[model samples]
Target: MKLHAGSNILLNLLVAVAVSLVVNFSYLLLLLVDQKNDPAPPPPPEEVLRKAERLQCGALHVSPDGHGYLLYSGGDSIYVPMQRIRRLGLRDGDSLVAEVSVTHVPLAHPVMGKVLRRNGAEFDYGSLFKRPAESVVLTLQLIYYVLISFILLSILTPVRFRYSRRRFIVRCVWCLVAAAGLYFVALVTEWRTGRLVFNFMTPRMLDYVLLLKCSFAVVVSMLYGWVYVLIMQQQAVAMENEQLKNEYLTTRYNMLVGQINPHFFFNSLNSLSMLVREKHHDKALTYIDQLSYTFRYIIQNGQNTLIPLGEELDFIQAYGYLFKIRYADKLFFDVDVPEEFRTWLLPALSLQPLVGNAVKHNAITTVRPLHIAIRVRDGYLEVANPKAPKLETEPSTGIGLENLRSRVHLITGREIVVVDTDTEFIVRVPLQNPAL
Candidate 1:
């Protein structure tokens, strides 16, 4: 929410000026037209006495007439028409409620003057300045100043000055200082010229004080609003950046482990070489097809955060075809995937590595064929293989299992698990939905 100091200063200035102008313009219309000097005039003692008699008569009488009624409270009496009181939405006496009525005096009185001639409803400044128009103008100007001040301060504070309490306070002080400057300029100009600037003072002084005050008020309000909005925008951008950073690190780890397990690669290559050496050219081409399929699936889908569990299982089935062809009657696989789990997601190549591990590590022959199974249940993909370790002397890199686990963890924030029982080695990988 922190705002640039220069911008904050400019904004406060603009807001102060705008508020001042609005106040000046409203007073110009409502109060300034009648402001003037006038000679002395006489009083109306008789009408005042009649109104007082009406108040007292209504106060003592049970009912003045069907058309009017009286109310008395705290040694004061008021007389009002029954219709008017009803129109005011009053019932009985409700002390907490306020009642208001407006009374207007005629701009011209036939009895007071030499019957002043008029053109298009000309305003009367009134005798001896009895109307006190300057007071009305000053009240309006004060109200305008207050409204502008509140708006400017609200906008400039808090969100804009988020960095430090002191900075926010400083920004507010500047706005008030600008207001005080306007007040002083007006007060001093009045003292010198015998009139406030906006109240028809000379054009030069009027332009200077009015323009500066109004412009400052408007600019300050806009700056505060702009700073607050921009601060929120920056915060959202920062959060997005943090999220992307975490995703990048996760993707990098997945990529490093996603490289095909070297042992599996070499073993498949060795199997293909043996097929060709035995002059089984067609079957070697079939093994080549299986090898190509495995690599292509990984390369194409590895960048994907989620692939359908069905797709990974399909790749496993294709790899199983190659293993069965190589071991002939000595390799078998069973699939137990539920229809519901088909569309559920796992990390790309998540299942293939576990099946590859079973094929590479287990012993299989015509008399003792290896058995592998793939199943989906309870939001997990379960791959179980017969525990028939064949290459006791072979060193294990453990890269394939670790790669699967890393991918799962990166995408789902859940663990990939391996379990071995007396007869079966099982891997369970948690499933998820794609980002879409």
Candidate 2:
């Protein structure tokens, strides 16, 4: 099973306690052997024993009635019972206070002189609970753990910043080499002074290798967990950005395709009504055909990001026919696109919106003629029309122009510009770079 932060900390603490206990036990055993023949030293000083803080170090073993724990400090053992508190009343990792007192005895007897001579009496468990040093010990352990974590994260996480498969393998080898160096250092110190450091291994290469392997396993597991979490965060951010872009593109496409104004449709129908009343049946049929072609091109281009300039101009010509039918002799529409410019790619529906904006905002009548012009000039496409006053009942919303500007900006690094020259309303759009 995988170890969580709490479980890992608990395991580390247990291992430390076990190692300390073994070292203390071995020291006592050696003392007993020395005193087996020689007379025993006096018991540890009363002042030193009394001054020793009683540190309760063990897991809280809860009981049915309330709570209780097996408390051990030095050679003393006792039980602490809390019969009044309920399960919900306590929290995990909580500690209690305790004070302890004991009397030690020395032995001249063989093995007992070194080992058993240091034995002490078991003090009252209640007195110890009243002032236990568990909190201090736990606090110190917490600081130790935080410091170790900070050091490891600072060093290894940065290493991962420079990490790759090759680097990881190299680092693993370096850790083994450093562990070998440390093992040799420990062995030399022990051989001279006859004391072990951390009891990592016996005096052999095989034992040192096993100890290094275990430590490296623990460190690498931690590194992998951290790295996995960072990778997941980065992937999530990238996915979210992709989703946002797709949504924006979909919305813009739908807006451009579906947004032919109702005003334009109604006005064209009115003009068709006038044409029929005048008995121009042939012209009426031609106007209907042009209208159909205009709407068809719009629908077809909805699914495409870009279309040939030639195709767009053909659609614009059909749309101009509908305008001619509406304005009769009062409006003139002209196109001057060069043959070389015909193959240039432009965003679909780019021209229609600009023409539609002019039709919607300006007035046209037999008495007041409106001349609209389109041409490709000097690396730009210019659409210009005479500025006529708005008819009193004309729809005044300028959303079509605004939508065109935004779409142009998205498709190319250019914006459609409008210039009013006393009598003309001119819009200039730079030729979109095909490379873009």
Candidate 3:
């Protein structure tokens, strides 16, 4: 329920107004009743009793002619209208007390002003009725309710830079707490425009009108909070799902690009032919075995997310053999990794791209042999080789190294660092400690 700008303001404002209207529904009904039944001077008091607006008490008596009277107020009866008797459901024996006014009419009796009580219990006029339901008074009430609701929603719904589980829990707790507090405040003050201190302690605890207004306030506030939390949680989950879908897609793409594509397949065969031409049968047999193992390793491990460093290095040994046999003394692998780092895991085939890039981009010769070092340094698997740029070389697309970098990050949430200087090209890939 985070509020955004423009259209969101109008939507939230409407939500606030709706909550206010519902919460004050009973009070609004009372307003409408008052507007329809505005009490008029009751048939000119039959006998002027006292000044207007004085309290009068007597027994209620309604006649068949649609007229009613409160008998025995200071030995004189007061005129009560039939509509008031019907609204209050008054009976002949019922004791009633109300404000009375004197009107200049002969023998009509003093007219009732406002009903204050029936029997022993007090009546809440504020709850039962309010005048001017559709007048400027009602408009003021509407404005008051709208303001309260708008502010409440503006505070309740907040914009957050990022979603957080802990913060969400805290906010929900606060919402219920605020609702509980607002319940008491609403009881003490009027929810509508009658009065802020309207009818306090007038209605008994189980009064239906009182219960309706209070319950609506509490329940609607609680419901608003519940709906807000539900929407926010759902949005967060949807965003997370979308992000994972993209990551899954990227990982699949990297795996496809990682497959060995016969880059050195024909080169190995040419080296093997030279060995057989020189009549070195044993060496050629060993070369075929190593070449077979390299291809098998690539195909088998391509689907895997991660493998032990030792397992990857074993495959590299088979892979490096073909290159070593081709270069002979011009290229050499200086392996210096310890056995302790062998169990650490990294992405499968992570090192192959680095090795391929070293050979593809640099020139190796008898004058300055390509001494590629594979070692563990500061928790990283470091592969370093002295730069020997060929005088005339094709431009490198750098796709292989970029592919490895993306794969490693996708699997381990880590980055691969590459430093290419005048003398050496160093690539350091992070290693994850295997879970015990």
lDDT values, one for every candidate: 0.61, 0.57, 0.72
**Which candidate gets the maximum lDDT versus the true structure?**
3
Stretches of model 2 off by over 4 angstroms after superposition? 1-206, 261-264, 365-368, 390-395
User: In model 1, how large is the Cα lDDT of residue 218?
Assistant: 49
Clash totals for all models, in order?
A: 22, 10, 6
Q: Provide the RMSD of all predictions against the true structure, rounded to 1 decimal.
A: 15.6, 21.8, 13.5
Cα shift from native, residue 282, model 1 (Å): 0.6
Better of 1 and 3 by lDDT: 3
> Across residues 127-211, which tens digit of lDDT does each residue of candidate 1 receive?
3123334675476566666566655655454433344446555666676666555443443134432433443444444456555
- Once superposed on the true structure, which residue ranges of model 3 sit more than 4 Å away at CA? 1-207, 210-256, 259-284
Candidate 1: residue 294 lDDT (0-100): 80
Ranking by lDDT: 3, 1, 2
TM-score for each predicted model, relative to the true structure = 0.55, 0.50, 0.48
Q: Per-residue lDDT tens digits of candidate 3, residues 94-167?
A: 87767878888897678887776667566666556453334554455455556555555554556553435566
Query: 9, model 1: CA deviation in Å?
Result: 18
Candidate 3 has its poorest 10 consecutive residues by lDDT at 42-51
